[model samples]
Target chain A: MSASDHLIPVVVSNVVEVNPIIKRFEFKHVNGDELPAFSGGAHIVVEMLDDGTKRKNPYSLMSSPFERDQYAISVRRDDTGRGGSKFMHEQVRPGMQMKISAPVNLFALDLRARKHLMIAGGIGITPFIAQMAQADKLGVPFELHYAARSVSQAAYMDSLADRFGDHVSCYCDDQGESVDLETLLSNQPLGTHVYVCGPKGMIERVVQTATSLGWPAAHVHFEHFLAPPVGEPFEVHLAKAGIDITVGAEQSLLEAVEASGTPINCMCRGGACGQCETVVVACDGEIMHNDHWLDEEQRAAKQRIMPCVSRFRGKRLELDL
Target chain B: MTIQFKDESFRGDFTYANSPSNIPRFPFPFPEDEYMYSTNIEPHHAARAGSPFENAFDVDEHYVAEMKDRALVLADDPGRCQALPHMETAGWDFLELVMVSKARDYPDLFKLTMDGDRWHWINKPLQIDDTFTFGDSSTLPCHPMEYIGRQVQGDHAILDQRDGNLWMDAGIITAQADWSLDFDIGMNFFEWHAPVPLAHELGVFQRALKFLLTLPQGQPSRRLNWTLTVNPRLDTSPENYPKWGPDRMTVTPENIGEKVHLRVELQTFWRLPRSNAILFPIRTYLMAMNEVVTQPKWGRRLHRVMRDLRPELVDYKGLSRYHPILVEWLSQFDDGAPTSPGIFPD
Candidate 1:
């Protein structure tokens, strides 16, 4: 499963619907039968095999983290997406025993203070519902700010408002407007933490506000609905392997290594996890680490690399893979 | 996108979770942003907050930086107030814990206390007067009929007798530093959550795999505990979820001067219902990284990539968009884990 599952998956044994774009399945894993407790902003990754080759794609976990019984996730019919998401939406169906992974999360609610500021664009509201339910049960606190192109395309609104009361704030581009970043951020009491999930611009804007407020980068968090494009390239050395390969500007370090027949076990090719980690053999280049898998110390030391999506910092570098 | 409020004047260090001593005691990696923004620094200040709640999280970096070597703890962390902004979605009772030390990562933030079921920003705190008969029995949930008495802190606050839950909680950021009713800032109790994989038991994926348990009832699958961080790209990506709950989780017997090594494992499975009609039940695996070794590998890879992309491309925005949080997958190697592929493949 992708990192978002929180290492907990909602099991489904029945396929209620299937199409080239989405798959609706069901299962049981309650707290005696309880599925794991997943916060809002969580997701599940599915593994597929078109020809005995494994393929995995992460999808949004729409089920509320508050629900005890069965949970649900809605996946787009990503035909253009690799076999993982596209496969689930296209060919898989009901009564079939489908396996899912536990949820490993990067997105959870703020634990310290009372109050949650949820910003969801398009289908990003899925996980917020779960957090909302949990928030309700604890009476700790939270608010949902949902923004979408239109209400029709918006996943859930009325249910969220009804359950949450005046806490639900709506912003839709279709209405010729959307959330006012400055006003929203400015109006918030200092203790409140921010969470946003949606397109690139929306997430970035929120982060900017948080940063501008001098909120430590850690406080204002967001989950990108999609990955940004890759840029530049350079050489990486596999120290242990004593191999150095030149990554052309457009070429991924992974592609170059794989092309040379140096097998590196990699699962998520998008550089979201620490799967394709290659150690530094030696280097004389700038290091631009992009993976969350590394901590502050590693980033400071400058030895490893995620060849799949990472690029070189200097003219050359080294890896220990 | 983030909504900016006009008033930036926040007073009072967020007395998140704290212990009963004059030590900085909030856990590092404060949950989602249950942050502490205190510029208060004292050597041996200890004040007991008579209110309800327990724990600490989200220490303001500026505050943390100032209180380089101190201990802070909340004997009882008050529940998240409902009237706060964004109160609708963040519901649940929460207790925070934290500790600040002159030492680096391991010693900086330590000690913790918590329950199996977590508390959130919305839930009420436990009360000494509140009681229920629960002993690992299998029963569905429903509202209960139990009552608790109240405990007041001079004129500062009131708490439930059973569990020390407070009612009519006052504001922290909103309150003035001079607000007498708010928690006294001079105390240095340390509220904290011990890191899951306790410092002593760091292991690779292969060895870490032993601590896994399958679903006792549902289709046989497992789950694992993991931490998240932004990497590969500095951007943690659009997929990274926020940790909205308590930032600090305590290791057992934290105050008794004991430590337990943790082993987070990997659990793999598919999400499908057994009763529904389906042809193929897809199987997938999830895992927690063997953090000790894997983190280094990630650092190595990322350094090279950054060197390749150059600084202009290394802006926080590009990096934040790509950072991957704690992701788990089936381990593919013996000494180490196979590299993770891009979850959001283009």
Candidate 2:
């Protein structure tokens, strides 16, 4: 089947600016049927068609899983990044028809955990919104430590506090409030799982502190979808598909391949999901590894590449796409 | 369409026999004249009407007898149904998946009603009607997995995903083909499949595991696997090998058509919504050589596939005992004619 065959048609039912930077968009099935059920920490790839160009961006579903009639996602407009989020903010309006992929969870909760500790930064609070709702329904104890720029910039602060009571903790950078990762990671109960989603620095600090505090690697979880960085233009030869595509300076390798009419199954266009991993048949220059999927050893081996974000800076590069 | 439930037996008297109409729809596993280990997974979309692939869960004429046999096996050994303590939520997820799918796909045979958390389920085929809270296990008569598993055909295994691997955490497997769920519980995907010959060296499991790890919520996939069985026995498990092993030796040239059977498993994989675990259902279909030859296409292709089958696979699938006699008997059905490309009656 073609890649677009599985997309679910949806209509923008409502849009609300939660904060100056974040806008919450509610999507309902175009035919008013119940959307597919999803679990906590799941994300859907919203497909945006603009000027004959297709852009897909993964956004965490902030609505509760039980609410199947509509799905809600909070988008933090990235002015400097690719045009997907900008389209969501400016062009997208109520009654507009669009398509989105089914929910895929790369950061699902560990149900066996006795306690859950969540850390969020800015838009990172999106996934935790649904997760907190699930934890409450399951009667599992959890605590949220969320940090934003300030009270005015914090999205869903009041409603979260009002609904979750003392379980919600807000930290504002302007007020000199920051999460103490070391203190948060120390002396937690056994079987406590820590999930952190935020900026690169914040996620690294949480992971490092948890490790230094003797937490097992399995108990530490993090989700960060890296936007493909702009790189110099390069040429890639699709050996199996018998096609050649040029990775423009502004476009990702995945976009270039998709434009060539090659069926590449991708879920989370971001670097986190390994769905778009391709074998590096040959390369004359260095392979820029920017994805979170491959290990240090695999990256050094240079036999595989995550086309979503990774790039090639060489005279000749071939992929077994 | 209403189904005509068959009153038959899978053990003891061994009175199981497929009706004449059911033979054409028998999921003949060989799409070609030869078979080897390949991923071979395809989208589990609903296909041709009246075929087994037409529903999320296929309920055939043997549904009543199969459920009865499962109950007998479970009564003899409760160890067949097992679930890890941490898999309770997954069990609930599995119960919801089956109840919802069956009620929607086969409305004539099943019904489900939901009022918030309160759920009422009815199974016309099994004469079961019960109401329970959606997520509360105490509301059900047994564990959610076991409670719903008993009402469905085939054996169901709930796989838990973590640390980049799938774990066989919970399952109700009474109709298995030699594998034991009790021993396989808590084993990772590779660990449970370690005993399978040749698939690992060929990188089949690696590719399959990677695909399943990202299996989306709505799109499920399925593949077919087959083995040879002597009788229409659903409980050819290793634990009960002695009771059924001797049946293989009873096959002779005269009784090969009646005594030997071809067992095909339509294994499907689905992603659970709540727990993010995968539900694997192995639906077994049995057809005696006599019923198989009724479909000329199946008879011709089965003979060619069996005659050219790899020696390793013949031993692996336990076809060594009666392989020569069975293949020789099937040779008469093959009249040196080229069969059609796909697996369907000519």
Candidate 3:
């Protein structure tokens, strides 16, 4: 089957400006069919075709899993980064049709945990909105520790508090309030799973603190989708597809390959999901490993590359696409 | 398309037999002359019309009888149906999947109507009409998995993904191919598959596990696995080995055609939406040698595949007792003619 056969056509039904930087878009099926059901912490890759450019961005679904008629996602516009989120904010409108990959959950709740602890930083609060809905529906005890730059900057703060009551706690940097990682990680009950999603620094602090507290590695979870960094232009030869393409300095390898009419199976266009991992058949230069899915050993092997974000800086690079 | 539900026995009487029309659609698994362990998985997209792969779930003439057999097996050993406490949401997910798929695929046989949380499901063949809340297990008579698992044909195991491995956390495995779900309930993917020979060394499980771990919702996959059984038995499980193990000795040259049956499992994997668990359905189809040879192409292919099969697989599949006799018996059907390429009748 063609890669597009699996894509669900959706209409942008509603758009809400949650904050100055965050805009929440609601998508409903183009055919008015019930969208596929998804678990909390699930994300969909929105395929955008804007100004003759194709870009796919993965956004965590902030809507309740029980809601099948429409899916909601909050996108944080990054003016300095790639333009996927900016397109969502400025170009996308109600009644506009878009294609999206099926909902995929890379950051799912560990149901076996006695309690669910979520820590969100600024725009990272998107995934937890749906996750908390699921936790509440499942009758699982959970607490949300949210840190934002300020009250006005925090997306979903009022709605979360109004719905979750004491289960929600907010920390605003403007007020000098911050989540004390050591204090929060110290006395959690056994079998508690901590999930963090946000700025890379906040995630690292949470993970390092949890590890220092002797928490089991499996009990600590985090998700950070790294936008494909702009790099120098390079040539790539797809060994199997028998195609040669130049990845522009401003384009990701995944985008360039797709532009060449060769479909690469991918979910999170950001460097998180391992779906777009391609075997590095031959490379003459250093492989720039940017994805979180690969370990140091795999990176050192130089035998694989995540095309979505990772790059190559050498002369002759061949991929088993 | 309507199915005439069969009323037959899979145990004592061994009354299960394929009709002339059903033999061609038997999913003859041996696409080539020889068979060896391989990942062999393919996307479970809808295929040719009138084939088993045409729908999300295939319900044939054996639908009613298989459900009855499942109920009997559950009654004999309630442990056949199990779900971990953490898998409750997954159980509900499985229930919703089966109900929605069956109702949509075979509206005449099954019907599902939902009014928000209240769902009304009607299984015309099984004579089941029930209304219950969607997510609340208290509304059903049993755990959601078992409740729907009994109504469907096959053994289902829900594999919970964690620690970069798939865990067999819950299942209703009354109709299995020798493995015991009770013994394998809490084992991880590698741990449960440890009994299989050769495939592990080939890195088959590792690759298969990686593929399955990232399996997206809405895209299911399937593969065919085959073994030889003594009779039309459904529960060829290790727990009941004492009851059916001796039947292997009964497969002599005289009764080879009547007694020895080719058991094919249409194993399909689906990613459940809510729990992020993989629903593995092992749907078994049994065809006696008498029914199999009814198709000339299948008869020739099975003989070649059986004769050249690896000794390790023969031993692991428990075909040693009748291996020689069955191979010799099947040799008569092979005219040394070249069979066609895919697993389909000429």
Candidate 4:
């Protein structure tokens, strides 16, 4: 991953619509020089404009980690998701330069596993592309299970089949072909590790099934695919800054606070990482906790808030900052 | 009239009805003539050897009174009832579970109907009758958990099982004895009981978790946890420290009988059918030490337990300040007192 502290401007060198909802983009240095190298499963935060508001969206690098000439990312257009993906789909174009943070790997491949089991739902397949490449380099036995609504929705299926052949399996819900996750989890070997990235319901089901079947939690992994649900606009008071920031209906608390000149540290921006949790001084209303990082008790405490995805609907909220 | 206390906290209009039959079957908790935290997983329907109640969730004469007390607590602080965002479904599951069970158990008080994704609930006791879309939070008059919790005479929590562990995620905990729901939400079963002295060494928590994960759908299990409280107030959460903490330090022999309460929690655990979350209902019963000694055996047991309890255990139970006084007061009955509190009658 890049060690630079500042974000670098990268040009959108190429774009391809792999499916109805997914667009794969290739980014390269503006001067056409080799970009910073990143390991498998690393993601770079792309800074985009959502109707003039600054938005940072993290996208996993799908390109092989062995090279650094360009970086690849896939964005799924989710009309129902937060506005970041919508902006990436409609506004971003080739030849346009966008600011991107250094790559960071929050879902890196485990090097010690005897075998790897990769599961994906829809666009969740992006992270596994780079991970499988690393597993190949390590000569690790692996299986890639891809599930999609249909053949058309399964992005990169042909490429994966061409590369891994029988090691890749695709299940399309439209065609009535389904993967029995219980059976898949039950048949795994002793030292095998399973990685799942998908919609919330799918991830919960896979994790629960694996756990019920006695699969060790250490061997299971998952990443959330979409942002949390949005709530009404609210006002935030930064104690240290002594300013009351009005977070818009579509804006996250983290974005509003950052736009006001006090940037909070953040990683995934999807509420999966715990980097942006800020101490809440006082709250007069209920907090809609949207982070996967905090457990139920922490969410209920009202003492802390994950500014990235969490929001509130109240007159005023005070943050310790 | 509201009798105001020295701590600025006042007791609501309470009539001290001391009929032994009205005691509502306290689940004596201590087994083998000693006290220790163990897995102690018993079948939900299993009859307690000496209990006056028969069902997993037993409602007694105090149901209406306790519900009234809960309503007062909630009115003063609505933060006492919170159902996290993801727990919306579990809340509905809880609502339906109570309505259906109550409709079946006490047919006159509750009724539930289902038509596809819509449900109609009739709570005769609360005078609520409405038809709303299932799984929609807005359709309900209040948060689903609070709506049900307010009607019942117990504190309830929903624990979701994920990744081979149960998470104490959602609940309306208006009457926590000494624990804080704010600090325990989303915590695993073990983290919730970390303060217990020897549960870890005895593998009690592990055994309990295993038993809970394997608990069948309709079959609930129950266990007991007991402690001493300064008053009959149910909201003993740390958030109310300033209001109740000093009373613990000021208690003495003169008022120990009236100030000290033997608090026993009859905790019932069962799995929700729809959400698959475990529904835990904790019913608390508090009796003044003076009223308890009316039962000679119980008085002697309380005296012996308080005297022999380890110092660390007593401190952890929050009885370090006035326990010695409590022990002294119970010693008067050590040589066998009368079968009644003759001088303490209402």
Candidate 5:
């Protein structure tokens, strides 16, 4: 990768305060470069300064890439969060600067699927927004299920309704109009693809209902906003350092390394969060790992490790680095 | 708590020799562990003691039952692993990261998501009223502008043509997205229906990143972009088509099941001043087996020692030092007087 590969910078130009709690910042290329058009389920990695913490994070994009130099991202305030949200809410503003990765898509709309069933619980509505907008434009058949606590808490209530109207379904537990996911996803059409987002609960309902209803894993697509930590512990040996860092059963190899004072540069720590990646010359054992950076063969192949969340199947092994 | 290599940074007892049976060995000339990973052609030998999943995942009856009685043992009580607690993520991490980023970025950006890689919604289609939006009907209108809009939304980010500044700001802004922490408090898989297998899915992603980050920077002077040639072992199994991506031929897993070997080039770049770069060059070669890479004796020994040292899985897994040391000793290479590598600036 070029020094340029690791140095893609993002700038904020247009800012829209979506709500008292959420603010949307539109980022663009000051160099007048063509930004990658991303699918509805793609996100980019960014690096920023926080009051207490400094690291990069993986964030999904809400705006369509159709407009020039215009990409919108929404932020909510969380003083206790690991510094990013609080920073954006209180510190980040239009004209502020940051670094980001090229767009990567994992939740793309299936054009082959004749009909799209888009579901959003709370904030999950964003990714599907582009889909909804396009479906309307193409006069395609689609449905939007917007779920929130109530009207006040919903972020884009007016815009969703104004744009899609009757085709859109709004659900608020507080208002008692919540739709049952099982029924909605039940007896689905052959070419129907499901895009479910929002809170963990809504995602869960859609997935469970769809699965119980016999929807194939490929047909049901739900995006994970936060990557939960997983995997067994592995022994990591920095042969060069002559150390036997016993990466805790719970911690990732990357975390253990940093705790051991290895200043390995990392961007997104969540495996989906790709902040910590490192190379190894000689490794032995099946790499029981987590990461989007490698394909299936590479992952099972055991060539590299995301120390933050990867592990080894057997006992201790050595890393060439 | 641990033996940090950089400088006794953390508190730990075993700086070099921990257990009486194991001995540490470092390669000659290499600066640190970072150098080793970027420039080695070591094929990860398989273990004979069966799948190492038993010790890899911290499995429960419910967790195991969920995976058709086969679960890759995650960590050892991750909530309270003895060796390095800070090295791990917590429930708060999931809530803060997963929930917060989404909540903070709220209804904008593509609600930060995690699939094989980080992804979100591009949302807003080409145009709400463009009759030829997606099907084979390419004749919607006669305009050059719509094509331009499509170009912006589809491929520029990947080309490295767009400024990285925008991503930085947007990324930083949603740093503390903790909306998930607010509601549906606790529980592992699918809290309020979160996917259980996600833990495995996530592991697959982060591990891949670690491999990429540690790879030595690529050098164009020699036209040598680091690449990986995988040779997966799959003498068994029946299903097909396991992966996907734009490079579907490479990503879309083919009929070559289990022991499948494929070659891929890593798009890593680096052109260091001629005087300083290594003679071998920087590169990382990974070989994933999709549960087919069988382990030999060394693999079995590694897994065995890992489990035996378990309960305190931290030190247990670390015990694999014996595997390599034994291998070196058993093979033609010298083991007792293994040369050490330079720790810092050389």
Candidate 6:
């Protein structure tokens, strides 16, 4: 029905519940052969079937990049989300086959860097797990600074501690501890590259701190898992289709349109890719521009919207498809 | 005046005058009675026999002082010089272009000899003489662009033409007037200049891009853009806004003469013959309002232009609070002024 549906199939061979809402799923090629190899910071879209509707969500591969027999992905169920993680949590089981896209990496380790600083928050640690392994093989020094809600919610803490010892530092909220990103970043030698994958506030703070300290933009990298909260849903009139569609409170504009039998070609679905950019023919409401694909001026123009993440509110919104 | 630091010394060749004959030979930027943003680009023209201006790449009296400032700035903050991963070739191209420009303009002071891949470059000002193979990053002290940028007075930026759009790909821009080269890198021409008001609606930037893309490979073009600054300092970037923003609001009538400057940007655009990248060099010249008033025609025309500037444009240029005081200060000389030189082509 969509570009995501045309994917290679893999079977979930094993699952492990690391935390209250987190599960580690091990996937292997359906043909029982070696899977395609990926470097650090690669993510694959796992298409989940929710009430007969497919919801493709991106998850970072936690397993070592050197391992090609299977891919390990960690999913943290968000009960308040749009039902993709919830469906994977409640419906998916071992031996179940699902379609997945090839690994796409928007964030990759700088091999030429003198050192690598990997920082993560909550489930954002998934990507760093593979990055650290790559750094180890390349003999490049690396340190992981992780922040989690609580000790129980710090997935793979024991494994990370056992493997990395003092190199892995976890700041659990329950322990009343926090990370001093400034001190960590400031002390690093020149040519040290930093990669941050975490909550929106955490990522923004790290980037701002790095920039203020005069770090080149090329040295700082980041990735986000979830889009910001969409405000009150509204009705969207497809000008070319000559039909009015109501986008629900829990659905994206793209999803709502697809439910109406019109699916737009989208790749990242996470708002990084501009494949789903749609023109705004007319609008009587304020559009919540949440996508990173648009610059400040483009967002101010209000002529186009990325329905994959951005949403609208108020009385009426018309989109030119 | 000569300044020496760490075994590197430079002699400034600046000269000023009270009579028109002894004028500093600087190009005045105003062309009309009023100022507005437009795609005012024109083909590169040769300087006439009596013209007071220099060509696209000219080393003037401020060269030594500006180079010293560049050294200090780069020493304090190296982020000002950056070349993204994909801009390695463009960096080499930019470095070669600047070296060639200097050697051509100041043959007695600088020399560049190229034989196959080996290049022997000598810079008399900085006392730098070295021979290095082309396309080797390690052979240079730093990034290629940074190596040459430290010796020049003007800031450099290289834009690659790809997919029919010009992208601000690489550069070593330490003396940024008010923009951030780091934030603007990798952005297309329109996206980078999108925040400027009236330019988009007037199609100023769009028209400039179309003209820039069609510029012949070897024939360079030039344009001039002028604005007012609170001081002569060049690092007026948004990152350091707090340091300079308050000065604009607190300037008074008496102090306005010394505190304000007429900033002129001589922007040159040319395509690199080797890499096919467009090299943009911006040399900023600042003259104190006190010194500008000495020129009878310049002072009156500048006052009129400042007084008539639109309110929205004044705010856009961050000159809202200081412009009124500047206009009032210049009004004292507007009376019984000589018939204006009349609008001249830049």
Identify the candidate with maximal DockQ: 3
Structure candidate 2, residue pairs in collision: none
DockQ value for model 6: 0.01
On residues B140-162, what C-alpha lDDT tens digit does candidate 3 reach at each position?
99999999998888899999988
Models sorted by lDDT, best on top: 3, 2, 6, 4, 5, 1
Per-prediction DockQ comes to 0.02, 0.61, 0.68, 0.01, 0.03, 0.01
Where does candidate 3 clash, by residue pair? A285-A314
Residue-wise C-alpha lDDT for candidate 4, range A1-321, written one tens digit per residue: 111225878999988888889999999998887675455667778888666788777888899865668899999887876687889889888999988876655565554478999999888899899888877865789999999998988899888999999889999999998779989999988988899998888899999999999988878888886365566788889999889888887778887888898757666677765667689999998898878768888888889898888888766689976
Model 4 ranges off by over 4 Å = A1-321, B1-18, B46-53, B114-118, B335-346
| Model 1 lDDT tens row, A1-321 | 213223343345555443333355555652236665455555555544444434444555666665646667766554433335556655566543445555534455554445678888776776676667656655766778899776666655676777678889887778886888888878777678788888778888888887886765546767665321345656666655667677655446765676565667554445554556777767776677756557778877876777666677766676656
User: Residue A123's C-alpha lDDT in candidate 2?
Assistant: 91
Model 6 lDDT tens row, B10-60 = 212222212333234555777666778777666566675333334446665
Q: What TM-score would you give candidate 5 relative to the actual structure?
A: 0.44
Is candidate 1 or 2 superior in lDDT? 2
Report fnat for all candidates as fractions from 0 to 1: 0.00, 0.59, 0.69, 0.00, 0.03, 0.00
Stretches of candidate 2 exceeding 4 Å from the true structure: A1-4, A240-242
Name the runs in model 3 displaced over 4 angstroms.
Answer: A1-5
* TM-score per candidate: 0.43, 0.95, 0.98, 0.52, 0.44, 0.50
Candidate 2 local lDDT, residue A59: 89
Per-residue accuracy of model 2 over A1-321 as CA lDDT, tens digit each = 323348999999999998888899999999999898888899888888877777777889999987999999999888887777788999999999999988888889888889899999999999999999889988889999999999998999889999999999999999999988887788579999999999998999999999888999989999995467778899999999988899888778988888898878776778876888888998889999999889999999989999988998878899998
- The regions of model 6 sitting more than 4 angstroms off are A1-321, B1-23, B49-53, B336-346
Write down the worst ten-residue block by lDDT for model 1 chain A: A1-10
User: lDDT per residue, candidate 5, A16-55, as tens digits?
Assistant: 7777767777787767664644445555656565643344
